[model samples]
Target: MLIVRIPAEGIEDFRAYEDAVLPLLPEFNGRLERRLRNPDGTIEMHIISFASDADFENYRNDPRRITQVRLLEKSSAKLELLSMANVP
Candidate 1:
């Protein structure tokens, strides 16, 4: 799972980022389980699942994803990423 905190003003840029990267998920054997936005629109959270650690790593290292990261960095929005695991 990943939690992203983005400034409200940059939501459009973030959506662009999402549009660019989401297609790549299936290539890495990953899935976007959910996307949640705060009612105030100040934060966004993404829950993703991968078949394995290697799959997740591949997604992280994908060039398209990297490019999106750079674009996001250039935007006015700030972001935070958190990794989480399921608890049984």
Candidate 2:
């Protein structure tokens, strides 16, 4: 599976980003696998798994996804896609 990792900075932006992106996952043939927040106020993480590599690519290239990335960058933060790796 392909994993998308978003590390959010602000709580408001984090929630807003989530709201904007969550619904589109299924459209891109992906699923929201998990969301984790650091109690120490470091980062809010989201893990999205896609059905296929092409689906992941579609999601990565989606205009809305680009917009969200820009939004995060504008907020002086960013997101990352943890390349395919073995997970237990």
Candidate 3:
């Protein structure tokens, strides 16, 4: 999962960044399983999954994704990454 913190002014830019990038997930055998946002819009959580760690890494390092880093930078967004497993 990704926990994101956004500044008020950065919200549009952040959403734009997400819109531009999230679609690339499937190329790496990944999916964005869910997205949740706080009522105040200060925080967002994205649940993502990939076939394997290597696929995730591949997605991260993909040139297309790298190019979109500017959109994320433009948004001045802050992010925290978490790895999760199901409770079974």
TM-score of each: 0.82, 0.69, 0.93
Worst 10 residues of 3 by lDDT: 68-77
- The global Cα lDDT (0 to 1) of model 2 is 0.66
Worst 10 residues of 1 by lDDT: 70-79
Arrange candidates, best lDDT first: 3, 1, 2
How close to the true structure is residue 56 of candidate 3, measured as C-alpha lDDT?
96
- Per-residue error for 11 in candidate 1, Å, reads 1.4
* Per-residue lDDT of model 3, residues 1-88, tens digit only: 9999998888888888888889999999999999999987779999999999999999999998888888788878899999999997
Residue 25 alpha-carbon offset, candidate 1, angstroms: 0.7
Candidate closest to the true structure, highest TM-score:
3
lDDT of 1: 0.81
Residue 58 Cα positional deviation in candidate 3, in Å, after optimal superposition: 0.8
Pairwise lDDT winner, candidates 1 and 2: 1
Residue range 1-88, candidate 2, lDDT tens digits: 2222334445556556667877889998888777776675346566677888999889878998778865555445445656565569
C-alpha lDDT of residue 88 in model 3: 75
Write the residue-wise lDDT of candidate 1 on 31-69 in tens digits: 999989898766777888889889989998998799898
